[model samples]
Target: MARAPVLAAGGIVLRRQATPLIAVVRLRKRNEWVLPKGKLDDGETPRAAAEREVLEETGHEVSVHEFLGTLVYDSGGRCKVVHYWRMEAGDEPAYELMYDIKAVDWLPLEDALDRLSREHERAFLENVGPIALKAAALDGAARRKAAKPATRRPRRTVAPPPSVSEPDTVPAQFDAQVTQEEPRSTTEAAEPAISAPAAAESQIPPSFASDIEPVVIDAVPMRPSHASRRNLIQRVRDWLRRAA
Candidate 1:
């Protein structure tokens, strides 16, 4: 029986530095430029498959911030669903990407659209362009928000402190319950686990046990031919051994 055409996931990974750069791959023999795509394995979700395929085909670790729906196209009488995602290249490029692709080029948006293989692929790129751009914008906005200092709340000023009321002690039962539920000490509370450098150093040994004398074992023999040893000589040897 013929194997099913794989359900694939891919993307037109876009990066906007000075200009929008759409990552494209050039196939081997034909040398046609197209977006990264690959087969989705069993048990792997569409989004995960898309990200993994992109990373494998082109060495770029990306965050799938948005999904660009699915595309269906026929290949050899089988229907394949390709889940698309808008990915952003992290701080640095994953690795110098090279593949069956003759060359991996980052083309300008217009150039990418014009150079893409099919109308459907072009439409996919167009659909994802806005999402990628939006992600970039949101990233910029977050950075700006982080950089700007937070405005401090105004301190309340009382002209004269009002006469303090007598401390109304709570009931014994209530106090006992509250004490039981609440943390016994500062250490037990949800305060930050801030440790002194000296304390941290003291807690961790200078050298770990594994680091000192690491266990190393030789691998066992695993030859396929070891299974059939029923020759006459072997049988005779086995008989002799059994007799001994």
Candidate 2:
């Protein structure tokens, strides 16, 4: 009967920087430098195993992303299939390295390719390194774009509406006439002097004037007797006859 293949999982883990770096581990038993990977634990998924193995080997917490390709190779007369995912590590390590790993090295893609002990792992990294690097670079750019502050437009200054002038109340000619008049004294105001022509025009009629005879008026006025009143009336009748 044919034996089942040994299933393992790992990552192409990157530490974000100006130029990103990848993680590689030195094996304690074999003294060989290799990509971080391990066989799955009981009831553990491939993706979960990949995250756990990467954290254990690299001693840094990581965020796992899209899956890369798989690697099928023969190890000790058995088929070993390893799955890899793209992952990003934090700025600092969160835990100590596992007992199986002696030391961890962070390096650029070409150097990591040269340092890896196995021929298959190196070949796999070369094919997928550029893809992972590009993806990480895009992610970093997106984050920076989100963090940048937005520009604000300046406010407009509105000028106040033009002032309206009120119309004049009094006419120009009337105002000038009023301003030109001279002030009068108390004596002139009390007895106003009339012109000769005005006084002549205001005189009484000739008929009435002739009839007004000069009669002596006493200082103290007394009531006339009936006989004196009759005499006065007779004199008025005689005057009327003469005028006619």
Model number with the top lDDT: 2
Per residue, candidate 1 scores C-alpha lDDT tens digits across 1-244 of 8666668998768765767677888778777878888887889887888888888767778877677777787766887778787777654566765557666777777788888877777887787776777777787789889999999999989699665886578789989999888855777553344333334435655455234442233444546676454343354454334333
Tens digits of per-residue lDDT for model 2, 90-185 = 989999999999999999999999999999999999999999999899988899899999878887889988658765576889778888885667
Those runs of model 1 whose alpha carbons end farther than 4 Å from true positions after fitting are 1-5, 96-98, 153-244
Model 2 segments more than 4 A misplaced: 158-244
* Model 2: pairs clashing at backbone N, Cα or C within 3 Å: none
Evaluated at residue 97, the lDDT of candidate 1 is 58
- How many residue pairs clash in all the candidates, one count each? 0, 0
TM-score of each: 0.56, 0.65
What is the alpha-carbon lDDT of model 2 when measured against the actual structure? Answer: 0.87
For all candidates in order, the CA lDDT equals: 0.71, 0.87
